[model samples]
Target: MRKDSEHPFRQFENDPGRHALVELFVREHCGKIKDLLRDCVPLAKGSFGNILGIRGKAATALGLALKEYPRKYESVIAPFAEQQRLSVNIPSAPRIWGSDQADGKDYVIMDEIPGVNLWALPQLQELPRAARLRIFLDALGIVDQYRKAGKRHNDITPSNLGVDATGDMRSFDPDFMSDLHQSDTDRFENKSVGSPAYMAPEAVINLPAGRGPHSDSFSMGATLIAAITGEILPKLLGENGVNDYFFYMLNTEKMQREIDVMLHEIIKDPVLLKVLLRLLHTDPAQRTVEPELRSELESGAADHRTMRYILDDYSPAYRTAVQQWEERMGMAGEQEGFMRTWLRRTAISCEKLIEFFKGLRNV
Candidate 1:
């Protein structure tokens, strides 16, 4: 497949005709459309459509966010909106107020959830490690709920997530929410549905079997890494760029090494590092948020050891040994005997570390 320099949904923003159509629809449906549009602020622009924050009197009285899409997506957006409207209220998800079709456009009015996007939250990195981990675990729980309900957010990114005034995490932009039960023909295939930077490897490559809850887990893992490191997945993938990012994702060995290096740079807790690596496993079948792990995180019952403390108090010597062995192996020449000795030593130490981490999985 060729590089997708531009997602098809982006065209809606650039099409003069589509803009005119949205303007016409607002004029006909929203009384004093000019005044209302004047007060509306651009909140976000995603692959599927644009989200505008309703401000002034309309916003105060209605407390709604306006999301619009080209009429061509009516079949997809309409059903998804209606499903959200009827579903039992999911506390972490934005409520869909209603949907309408007119003038070659489909509009969804939803609750304008209060608070900043996850990425924009102030002092996020400065927060305690457990606090930061809680935020993401809560976010992951929201995704898990959607999965249990036979729905998939499809697009899970830091920008699409919010931390409400109550400190609860809420997922935004439901325009790409999809039903897992929907037939393949009705689904948005391939890379057309998600944010390129955070999409799952299978979704990025448009695999034949399609995506499921594990796909969301992969995105969540990437988001977790971003929250901790302040670097997006593309940046973590390095100079080879996004195309290589996708290629590396499909190659398990390379993906593991990349994730290990990135996480090790910022996260010192071995258990946390292992959990993240599992979530980001290249194979969808192997990627998951373990129930025990999720429960501990969500309940705030998990270990609250600080990153520095964890490194200092828990097996620092073993980690140091592993690091030194790796460095030596990297600098070693092609002497078979020298290489074999360090390789065996590194493998044994890594196994002990892995066992130590495994014992802490429940902690």
Candidate 2:
């Protein structure tokens, strides 16, 4: 566990002046916040600022994302205020109390949310498989509501997901959130704005492809796999050198059988297994829970396993990318057959994945 003294926001440590600023802000915003300055706890540190938890009058904890940037308070605080204006179905998410700027810094007070981050849990693997499955579903439901409201949660990872005291899932941190209801005129600049470990294949190559709810599905899918298998998806994929093509191939019946064999050692239900496999579809359009996929899920065909993945049905972009890759491989062995080339590529991906996962584990 990280100690409070080791917290990155050292500027606030033993600083009576900063504490006074917090006190002044709370005194002014007493109608919205109900915490004494003495109860504040530095919960986390992010790219922009420190997340402080306040023990308020209510049963639940109140949080504050206090801006610690050198400047640009408007840029840091505006979006969080705008995001708080919107709400999702989840009881503990983006339920922001209010925002205020004082002492040349901005702060957005929100629900501290009970329980620890999913990754920080000491015994995530000890939890029942049913519990793990429910966590992903609940998280997806939250994502669905956000999408319905035309907002996109660009980041979905274990660290970002929180399991409350009652074991209910919660989604927080609207750091890179974008308004889907808005025009795409400014989409180009938001190319890569999420955690790479849970990012979709399209997201890794191009940000625009993953700038929607389907991208969230891809990330959630990876998170679900990790939850059940006691393995981080990126670490697993990196260890195996698995790429987008490998995930795409998992759509095939033969590949499904291979996956089944691999997962036999890890307990999983057939339907849930199919759901996890579907989430990793290389194409963002197919991976996203569109009307058809939603209908399939609603109709209880999640475990049907009849979805055929023919090479001809492959997305043109995916096919072109793979073709270009194969062409590059052809340079190394001009006479290699298609099957041989695929096999070699698969071997290389596995080698790289293993190496990468090993490095991550060490870290």
Top TM-score hit: 1
Error of 1 at 213 (Å): 3.2
Q: Model 2: residues >4 Å from true position, as ranges?
A: 1-27, 30-39, 55-78, 88-92, 102-104, 122-125, 181-191, 207-210, 239-267, 288-363
Backbone collision count in every prediction? 0, 8
TM-score of each: 0.65, 0.57
Instruction: Estimate candidate 1's RMSD in Å.
Output: 22.7
Residues 1-363, candidate 2, lDDT per residue (tens digit)?
A: 111112111222123433333333444465443233345556666446777655433211112333233245343222755666663343436455456555555566654443456565433345544444455456667678667767766677776776543334667676666676432225435443456567666554442344544777877777766765667664554334546544544345544454445544453565455566667665666665445544434454211011111111222332332243224333222432433433343322444445545655797
Q: What lDDT tens digits, residue by residue, belong to model 1 across residues 294-358?
A: 66565542232232223223333423432332242342222234323423443234444455456
> All candidates' lDDT scores?
0.57, 0.49
In model 2, how large is the Cα lDDT of residue 1? Answer: 10
Which residue pairs in candidate 2 have backbone atoms (N, alpha carbon, C) closer than 3 angstroms, thus clashing? 238-353, 239-353, 239-354, 240-350, 240-353, 240-354, 241-349, 241-353
